[model samples]
Target: MSDQIKFIVDSLNKEPFKKNYNLITFDSLGPMQLLQVLNDVLAEIDPKQDVDIREEMPEQTAKRMLNLLGILKYKPPGNATDMSTFRQGLVIGSKPVIYPVLHWLLQKSNELKKRAYLARFLIKLEVPSEFLQDETVADTNKQDISAMEEEKDQLMKRVERLKKRVETVQNHQRMLKIARQLRVEKEREEFLAQQKQEQKNQVSTESLYSGSQK
Candidate 1:
């Protein structure tokens, strides 16, 4: 592992919460106290970004810390450099907490000129690879679930549109049927009136012929 990573692990291990109690049982402090500690660590990384660390639960705070560390590992603030140059960069501008922590470790390493301390610090941190893998899997699953939900919503909208089209077609068919029935009724009434007029004209002609004969 790189010196920066080693330092981050070391600093995390040295945290008061981790030093005083088991990290697995993460309830050594109250909410506000826990928030303060988290912010203090984050301040070493990016002081301006430390707005609020208060969470409804301790697990949330722990998760946030883990995520921050992951980001530092994947996307460091600046280009990789030797321990000396890296230290200078921190003095110039704010960097992740790992930069300062590693600077301290590098100084100690130069003074002692021994690898034993570094080895012990690594052993003390002992972060599990499976934990990082699990985080990755969880994120992937969440994305997949979100995608499936979006697809489902799209299909529902399509079904609604089809339903509206079917209703429109049915309404149009009913209107056409009503119009055909009205046309047939009007033609039948006209035919009956014509027949009655013809019968009246025939009777009037017969009466006029009988009066002329008389």
Candidate 2:
């Protein structure tokens, strides 16, 4: 049992509580309140263990220890193993800040290995409906943000494609304008050459008539 408890403690200590900053804040349990809960649980387990809960245990460690106690059916000195008494003790023994932490732990414990025992022990627990609702809202907001980011990326890609297409069209129009100017210049040159040929033909005819008359 001690080995199992030590393993559980080690596992709990290694959890990424700092990464779940929002969830921790949502629970709102202060350090001192968490310490008291840890001390109580530790005392229940072994009064002679000689470890100071406040000095040695971190908040995450305490929360995990409490979870283990609930799972292993470690009833306190005078309380029954039922959910109501357990919840009342958590609320009354600790400060108001402990409620959120307690709720969070209970919610998480339901998915743990010894969940059947925990479920039975905490069957009568009344989780705050608002907490669950707030968590859902948080999740939905994250999804919305992700979707908006995806849409923004797609819009940027489309804008880039349109820019390339517009540039291509402008290049085509410029080529056509240059072609038109060249065609007009060629037509003007052809007309001038025809006029010069006509003038030369008239001069030759006048000269030939004069020679025949002489």
For each candidate in the order shown, give its overall lDDT on alpha carbons. Answer: 0.48, 0.48
Model 2: per-residue Cα lDDT over 1-214, one tens digit each = 3343333344334433222223334235465645554444344333332355556534334344444444334434332333344444443444433443333443344343344333433423333333223333234334545666677679899999987886778577788789999999999999999999999999999999999999
For model 1, the superposed segments whose C-alpha errors exceed 4 Å read 1-35, 47-49, 74-131, 136-214
Q: Model 1 — TM-score against the truth? A: 0.24
What is the Å distance of residue 146 in model 1 from its true position? 13
Candidate 1 lDDT: 0.48
Clashing pairs in 1: none
lDDT of each residue in 145-199, candidate 1, tens digit only? 5666677679899999987886778577788789999999999999999999999
| lDDT of residue 22 for candidate 1 | 39
Q: Which window of ten consecutive residues has the lowest lDDT sum in model 1? A: 119-128
